[model samples]
Target: MTSFGRISIMACLLALLVACGGSGGGDRATGVEPGPTPPGGPVAPPEPDLPQASPTPYAEAEALFPFITAVDIPDDGRPLVDFQLSDAANTAITDLSSADVRFIIARLAPVPEGNLTGNWQSYINRIEQPGVGPGTESRLQATTESNGVFTNNGDGTYRYQFATSITDLPQDILAQANSEGLDLAYQPELTHRVAIQFSNGREPANPDYDWVPASGATENIFRRDIAATPNCNRCHDQLALHGGGRVEINYCVTCHNPGSTDANSGNSVDMKVMIHKIHRGADLPSVQAGGEYVIYGFRDSKHDYSDVNYPQDIRRCVNCHAGTATGADRDDLVLTAQGDNWAQYPSIAACGSCHDDLDFSRHAGGQEDNSRCASCHAEDGRAGSIQDSHRIAFEEAREAFKAEVISVENSSPGEQATVSFRVSNPLTGEDYDLANDPVWQQSNSSLNVRVAWDTRDYHNTGNNADNASSIAANALTSALPRGDGSYSVTMPLPIPDASVGPGIPASGSGVAVIEGHPAVAIDDGGSPASIPVGDAHAFFSIDEPDGLPVPRRQAVEINKCLACHGSLVLHGNNRADNIDNCVSCHNPRNTDRETRSIARTPPTDGKQEETLDFKHIVHGIHAASIREQPLQLVGFRGFTTYVYDEQTVHYPGRLDNCLACHTDDGFSLPLAAGVLATTIDTGDDHRDPRDDTVVTAMSSACSGCHDDAVARAHMSSNGGNFATTQQAVDNGDVVEQCAVCHGEGRSQDVSVVHRVRELP
Candidate 1:
């Protein structure tokens, strides 16, 4: 017998046993007892004695209680369903009346055979074949009056008779099916789906629980395991729809199947097409070609997703439909059944749903064949594979220009220190001669080779105030090319004055930062894309009398940022892709005065300056949406203002999910005490007001996100203002008292303030 026939036969047998008051077998396994019948009135059975258990141990219990065990659609026209409502211990739940149960019956139409022509009518015609017509409410006999009525069998089971004709379909739909030679009475190919929602006297907060029999079916043929909900929820926060009521993908697919279409837009509402078009949004070729994708829902309300831009690269299919990659949760795209078209075949309809500009006639010759797609687009395919097509050239070739700092000679400050370094392509293991190769020569002439010297004891002390200077060079002064694939540059180092000491003890241990960026062009069958191939010094310390080489404390993990940004490139893409390198330039003492236009005037009331402090700038940029004032920054080009109202800069994930981009207790309070104060230009416009303000380190980071008037006032009250904090610090004031309340273990700590509460 066929799979459906076997399922139907088994369902009938189970229904028969329940009707005759026989236990549906397997009582010992469930620890359930068959109840005795009562006298006279239909002989009601006694409730089974159940063991006391936790409120929700359903996962461990493997309980099949309160289940719609069997649904029977007889050939002779009678349609009914048998239900067993009980607790985890198999005690029958007779307290639930018929009103407590709600049922929805739907028909599962098979996938269309041919390619879906863009014409809506032609698509509908293909799905309207014999026993394959649209499963509308009228066709499925789904009406308030036609709802099944429950008849308690008095033996821990209930029978609900549909009391409707098997062929009870709308005239128009029935005529279409009949014309296509439909045998409605014996349509074994057409499957039915039954959904049930029940309440067991739970509070309104818990409300009712819903289940679909076909969704939970053990038989491989019946279960629908397409894109799981959790996968989508990774980015969407929560994949809820239909007025935020329906959340399950199983329930959504039932009505959004091949048979479904929007009556208002006359568009296919199939799950594959709808979801693809929605996520692709404004990027869809059709939408870019001056067309809008509008889904008309209940009351013909239109949902135009033309402005919805997906956060990540949409070409990264594995981001959503996970594969056999490390860290991936599930592989939903892998086909589990033969006839599941979306999983089994690469069709024009599915692909064109996103790439709407695809010329179907030109590509397929007006044919529906997609069998050859796998040959080129398969996962393992090389050149023409989907992965290869979307592979970013720069990301693949990033290691080509890797550089390392070899040594820093001449320990004393006043002497000419010799800094040695080497550059090599890690991918090819070829030593890159900066003075020889044309590309390297061009990069050297542009002074891409940079070296910075700073005291290792004081992290982020790279301002003009601290005797620190960075030098850009075209070639090494000595030009000593060693046999070990290394080169040297001798340059005069500024003498460190012992009297010019800050809060930290003046120590001789200094750090040397060597970085270089070489331009490389990668042709990946499309445009010849030019990108900066770069690397930085891991660590190189200058020997000092009393100072010890201390590296900067870890704050943010660059890998975590790359998880979303793919590659974190900033400052006109000249900077190396490392947080340590970024911190070296974007130190707390540095400001964007040189980059800012000297001719431009400041706003009358506020300053027109930009703080390049990594902590302040990074936090402010990410929290720009909540700021009351604009985040103005001066760069290589000119002044730029990030006004949240003017431009949208959405941080893809939850703001309070700090671990998404942080590591090593990065967000922990009681920050490094002696960190330099952050400068803030509280200018209303691009112009500086010359009233630059300096805030305490902690205050600057916190105010980036909490930049309201009240927060600013609070900071000001605590000697943490822009203009006064620096003066207070100079006068030996305790400006770092921010930790009094916002420190770790305090009542109002950073964790407490940024804590994410569950949705109400």
Candidate 2:
């Protein structure tokens, strides 16, 4: 059907339903169960003809950002450069009257080739780290409005004249910088950078930077581009930090160099060291060993990172660190201008930042410098080498053994399912036996398969850890037969009586998730240990006569989630490397209804149940730190309570940039038609997705992050409501007028408002 035809049909249906006071506002009197939407819980019916999405280009969205067009320094010997500021379209905004413009002028002290002289920090400790080192650094002077003279030429560009004179500077001040016959003055033959941050009183704050030769020379120009802002924006959306001005990493490294020090914390704020330390924040050995990681910022503001959690494993270097130029030499990229630097570049400062408690005397052979560090730590077959050392644990696990859900048999309506799976050693190219393999014989290890119904959403079946709707059985104990290099386990599936398919709802399928950690002995730093293999999921159709099963929607990319969360291993390795498996348990109908807190993590109020719905929980968990109320839940049959307090968590990205976690236009409003409302107050009854005083589907998700009263009131005023679960399911469901104002192509569309910078 034509797109317009589909939309018109839906529109007519909406009008017809509304005229009859459709299920959207279900008849509260007779409880006849208003019905227009689907009968699912967390997920709505897949919009067969979802509206066409048109994402706004980054530049147009951030129209007021200052894009520098030109830079010049006259032969007048002044330390100032004339620069122009342009709008998003590359045309001049001309007016800088209300803009906050600042500039930075700094010269790079390039490293010489084959020079180990400055490849690493000379930890001037027993006092503090980074006694002195030659690395990229900003100048002592940053152009402030008071110190620098600002000129409005009345053209599209403006100029900032510096108060300091280049020719009048002392030559002997940087004897170390000039040791190699390189002068720090504004020399055209040397590498110099001019950076600026411009923002109008109300427009977006943007940063601009350029690399120019003070004095053009080949040997002394040090520049590294291993990563860019887009790489960071991958997770951070738009990272605005350093007093919310220095957004670009290129502009940041100029100032946060080895030469700079936070006098208060007695720590180096160098990009290489500080960034490493910041990423390994709470995990740093020193921080874990009763010490705190802190950095004193501008005006001596104490920036404490002791409680900060690095989302992914710090050993995953490639996760955040990558570049095209191979670092400035990539070796001196962080330390010295030598080849094979960065991850391969072994430096005490960089390594010691995370392994702070390393016994320097015993390790690296008591080396005080980085000269001999490369000899033993070379990226070879040896284990401790950079590339070898940084390998993720999951990679190691993959080499030992992997589990795959081979097939499902005898899975008919109200029947037991025979699941076939295989565990094989990828390294040896052989299958592991469940009966004889010692790896599978460990008491601490386990193997199980979870059976959940209705791939559309588990709303039809109660897929809990200890429920029939979601049945999980020990595969090892239920092993039926061994044939064709695969093992079979037969387990009963509790199909509901109203099932439309052989055992499931029409258009629905089933999932048999091979979930468990069978111990496979692998090298853990020269010793043997056991690790769980990744979860293997196999989907089968219960309704489709053609045998083609439709799987659930891929909401969030696992790679993106793994990019930040090294391994999505939650609940002590029970669920590993699978978001699909997670949603099976964390569906819309799931909640901590029967939970009674054993840890007193401060029990819930008991008046309301905390939902385990993937949409609501994921949103609430991340936005917990900012939400007006905490995201509190109880689980494990009342033994556990998980509370994401507003005070503890600190989400690093912009909350409104829904693309940070959602896929496609998932976050865009006008939620799917049948996406059922979450049970807000389980009206004097058991907690279920079917019946409860609930927040409507649209309001449910919106309120997850924006949980303020005014926001809910606004939603309620605009056709979004809080009703009984059945009430919402009956009332044509998605009644929110949000899309008209906030949908994909609306004036305040999310695609445009997020201002997501697209990278080519």
Candidate 3:
């Protein structure tokens, strides 16, 4: 787990807000009720007079902008791809001109479970479903001195046959790799494009399609013969729609600016530096001083970001767009734009970790001005520059608390003993304890000392293994009851000596000595600076002279709910499968809307709100489809809006699986978790248990199979779409309340409203 370092002073402010009240109005509309329809019976809205498109690629992208005003991509989704070339105007690119080009494909790095990289790119594999069109293609071909070639074959119409003896490794890439100590082993040339004659050449129809970036300067024709992944469109379509213009579709060019030169140096700005500097906003004083923090393109486009608010301290590039830390693409460091000295321009420490002392202010003969640093580091920061750069700053250490061994002596050598530690949170002031006070969850705040002793290695026979029986033999497990403030743990030490055998040191004690707060920096009085957590340590004993076995102590990290509970895109798969994302959307607003009637109160009340044991809607829909549990779509809204589409319609994102992020080993860590249920409550009564008040349970809105037209209609509509006329009458006009583009009538597409109502 990446160290969040100290809970910078800024995080304290956020914690304060959370304490003052609940997170303010984080919930979105639960339903989309359609407004009154036209005079005639419901008809498809007139085809919008979308911007006319010229043959130019730029014009095409611009034309599509009007329809995608609201940002459809969920928040946790990768940031929108910016395509505007440095020094380029807001205008879109109309040219597709290239001297020579070849199609290239590359498989994205696999996403591991629960990791951010996993969260961002895991959907690629989720696309292997039936009936959906092919997903995105991946492959790379040869490159010229300056031009690289990439290839893409249409779905199911392409082949992947690799001819033996074909020159796979491009000679030039090999040469460059050899000289630079870089690995470019995968670079190759396509022997030939498989025949395009499809056995059944059927024109498959699917709204999901994407442009595979072309490589090489030479012209070539590449056709995909296999089915592509449906999830490909999830991000691509979102990028296009968000951009609102065709000239803006080259999202790959955003962080990977095709040709961007740095402000101060003659070198080009690499992807790593750009992304790092962007995400590390506050840490960079130059950036915090009203720097133009832009990613280029997607501006003035139609994205409904009205609800997409972020924490005040925006994360630096690596925070989200991490590098090798998450096991993502290691070459993510390669700069897209090239300059005389592009290879070693800047790195993470140089760019992402903005320690302003690296600037001229600390250098000799450097005039102490914002320009002092920007002059040499960021050129755009020059006087009258539109684009501003971030400045780095350092924080003077208030105090550093390192963990020290107060005392450690075995009462009976290994039979039983008590460890005592007096740890301190140095940042604490006379008025409060940072951990106990509101600052506990602050960004920079941390437990001064997290010392733990692990005998797992001592008793186990295998490498780094633990002896289950031996562990049970000791009282150490019982002594360390997770959150207990005391540090000393007593248990039976099987071996009298702390040292292990030859390979394994009999000195089997393993402990983590946590000390002063992690080094943390923040936006200064306009200067980028860092402060060190003063003085801390951990002390223990072992049998041998070698280092003792250590048990790593992990600090408590808050779980980000939006990771799996926000936006979802389902194309080839069942769209309604996005229940996980939907829950976050439909869940009631806890911070606002005080309901007088207890029955209307939101279910989320710091309790076990989601009862995973029972699911009525799932049974109702699938059962009725297969002729099992028969129930008519109930309520006015349901009948009009909640039509079920198994293939095309899908849940916005991942389906909520209890195990996806939770690991209940019976240990209750600091994070929120499911409570142990003693009894199975299949109670059908809709009443609040807190009080004897009448309450609407999730069973009504999300579980029951009631055949109510109004309910069905309401459920059918999308959260931000127009509610059907009947739904509007029942739930009120969604237009005025949530639609990003409000209009007098429902001229826009409100099909989502219809979708929710068409339940079985």
Summarize candidate 3's per-residue lDDT along 141-241 as a digit string, tens digits.
Answer: 11111021111111101111111111244464345334433333221232111100001011111111122222422233222111112211221211111
What RMSD does each model have against the real structure? Answer: 12.7, 15.6, 24.3
For model 2, state the Cα shift of residue 714 in Å: 2.3
For each candidate, what is the lDDT? 0.48, 0.56, 0.24
Give the candidate order by descending TM-score. 2, 1, 3
TM-score for all predictions? 0.64, 0.77, 0.26
| Candidate 2 lDDT over residue span 642-751, tens digit each | 66663345566666666666777667777765566676554443423344666667777878888888988988888787665555556556366877888878898867
Winning candidate number (lDDT): 2
Against the true structure, candidate 2 reaches a TM-score of 0.77
The TM-score of predicted model 1 comes to 0.64
Which 10 consecutive positions of candidate 2 have the poorest summed lDDT? 1-10
Worst 10 residues of 3 by lDDT: 118-127
